[model samples]
Every structure is written in structure tokens, then in C-alpha cells.
Target: MPLSEHEQRMLDQIEQALYAEDPKFANTVRQTNPAVHYKRWIIKASIGFVLGVSLLMAGVIFKQPAISAVGFIIMLSCTLWGLSGWRRVVGGAEGTAAPVEGKQPRAERRGMMNRFEERWRRRQEGDH
Candidate 1:
């Protein structure tokens, strides 16, 4: 879905703030995260992999040794093709999130211990 106008303004403000703080890093962040683009790629590649492999295996079963080699070729193509998709998943692609002070908390705080532990976790041990 497209961002609403209010959201677009908020994003603009955030970009301004980031640019003020660090122009270079802001440019880096502006580069769309690869993760956001990966799901479509994975799906397409997966389809191609399945089709290629299936055709190859079918060729092998028909006793047509000539096209049987084509089956291996197709299998190899799918293997490599599917692997590229896997590599993209491994690359840690994700949807663009609202740029914020920190990653959103995993969950709501539930106890005093949680507070203390979380605060400790956020702090550098050497600072004390």
C-alpha cells in the first residue's frame, strides 16, 4: 500500500533529521533495503526452479537419453537458480520499517525485573 500523506510528511521529517545528523548514512539508509524486494524474487525463482526440475525429471523417465542430458542441465539450472534465491533470503532482506530511535521492543514490559534487565542490556558495561 502507498504511504498516506501524513506518513509521507513524517518520513520527510525523519529524512531531514537523518540528513542533518549524517548525510552519508542517510543516503545509505535511503537506498531501499534489499529485503523489501526479495520476496517477489524468491517466489519467481522458486516457480522457475520447480518447473525446470520437474521437466528435467520427466525427460529422464521417458527413456529419451538425448533429452535426458537436457534434464540434468535443467536440474543444475534449478539448483543454482534456487540457491540464488536462498542466498537472497540469507542476505537478510526485509520490508522498510519506520526509521526510529531503536528497533521496536519485542514485547510490552511486564515486570520490574524486565525494566532493570532491559536498561542494563542497553547500557555499556564499561560505562559504569
Candidate 2:
């Protein structure tokens, strides 16, 4: 259900107070893109996966079953972590954002996934 008018006004007041107290934090929160956040999570998981592989290799070289088992567990956890975020990124890509009723410009109204992919593409182009 939607907020009642009184509740909406109260929420607006609270938001105003937050911005007044810490505009930098408010701006950061407002500009945060969920897709970028998920991407970072996936990158961290990838690093974990690499570490897990190294551990597994070390276990084999050193003949340690316990270390190998731990490495397997780490690989499993990182795979699951990466998969969860990958699903969100893919699902978000297929979804569209509804434009807010007021204030925000069209350029600023793109979906989170769209914005992230655009940034990725730009970086790729710059790299080449």
C-alpha cells in the first residue's frame, strides 16, 4: 500500500533532515547503483575463487586432505555468491525502471543495470 499523505509528509521531513545533517551521505545514497554494487560483489567472489584454486593446488602439492577440503568449501561458497549476484544483474537487465513522477531528468532516470552496462562499455572502449 502507498503511504498516507501525513506519512509521506513526515517521510519527506525526515529525508530533508538527513540531507541537511549530511548532504554527502545523502547524495551517495541517492546515487548508488545496485548493479554496480552487485558487480563489485561478483569481482570479490572471483578473487575468492582464485584464492580457493591456489589453496586446492597447494593442498595437492603438500598432500593435505584437510586443506583440500577447506579449499573446496571456499570454492563452493564463492561460486554461490557470484551466481546470486549474477542472477540479480541479469534479471535487472531485463527489467525497466518506472520514471519518478517529478524532478529527475530523463538522462538520470535510466535503470540501474543500463547505467552499469553503459559504464562498462565506456571503460572497454577507453581501454582499447
Candidate 3:
């Protein structure tokens, strides 16, 4: 359901509180970029296809039809691969889901030594 005006105001207030208290922390928490950020897989495949064509020319020069056939296969495979990834690249960031949102935000807990030191400090200061 869409938030009512009152609910929207409350959410905005909470966000403001978070930003005011620790803008740096809040910004850090929001950085959930995908590890597999698409960097033109299709472009890479095009380059590979070009290289395959070059290889085919080399094979022809060397008088090896077998090598030429292999190069042709390589070119075909690369062209197909490039075409397959074309749609994904065009879809952009919205197509890919943020990794952090779907799963729990895993916190690295304080180790035993850190806890012990904290306890020791509190005791010396005469506080719990």
C-alpha cells in the first residue's frame, strides 16, 4: 500500500535523524553496488570475434583449412555470445538487483578480546 502523508512525514523524519546523527555512516550503509557490474560483455565478445577473424586469415596464409575451420567456429561462438549479452547490457542497472537488499546485512561481531578490553575499561572506571 502507498504510505499516507503522515506516514511519509514520519519516514522522512527518521531518515533526517539518521542523516543528522551520522551522514557518513548512513552513506556507507547505502553503498550496495553489484560485484558483477556489467562492463560491456558484448564489446568484449566483439573484440574476440575480430581476433577470431584475424586468426582465420592467419590460418589461410598457413594453408591449414583445419585451423581456419576452428577460427570460423570461434568467430561464430563469439558473435552468438555477444548477441546474448546485448539485451542484458541495454537493460542497465535497474535490470540487476542490489546484492545487499535481498540478504541480511552481515555484521562482523566484536571479537572476545575486544569485549574483554571493553569490560576491563568499564570496571576500572567503576561502571557496568
Q: What does candidate 3's lDDT look like per residue over 3-121, in tens digits?
A: 56997799899989999999998897767333233346677888989988988998999999988888899899999888667656544343455544544222444645566767778
Per-residue CA lDDT of model 1 for 1-128, tens digit only, reads 23569977998898799899999988877786765566566676677667666666777788777665675676677667666666675542332344346544324425555556556665645444
Worst 10 residues of 3 by lDDT: 100-109
lDDT of 2 by residue, 39-119 (tens): 988999999999899899899999998898888899999999998888787554333466446635545567665666667
lDDT of each: 0.64, 0.82, 0.73
Question: Compared to the true structure, candidate 3 yields what TM-score?
Answer: 0.42
Q: Could you say which candidate leads in TM-score? A: 2
Q: Flag clash pairs in model 2.
A: none
Ranking by lDDT: 2, 3, 1
Q: What ranges in model 2 sit over 4 Å off?
A: 1-11, 92-128
The whole-model C-alpha lDDT of candidate 2 against the native structure comes to 0.82
Error of 2 at 102 (Å): 25
Clashes of each: 2, 0, 0
Off by over 4 Å in 1: 1-33, 92-128
Q: How displaced is residue 1 in candidate 2, in Å?
A: 14
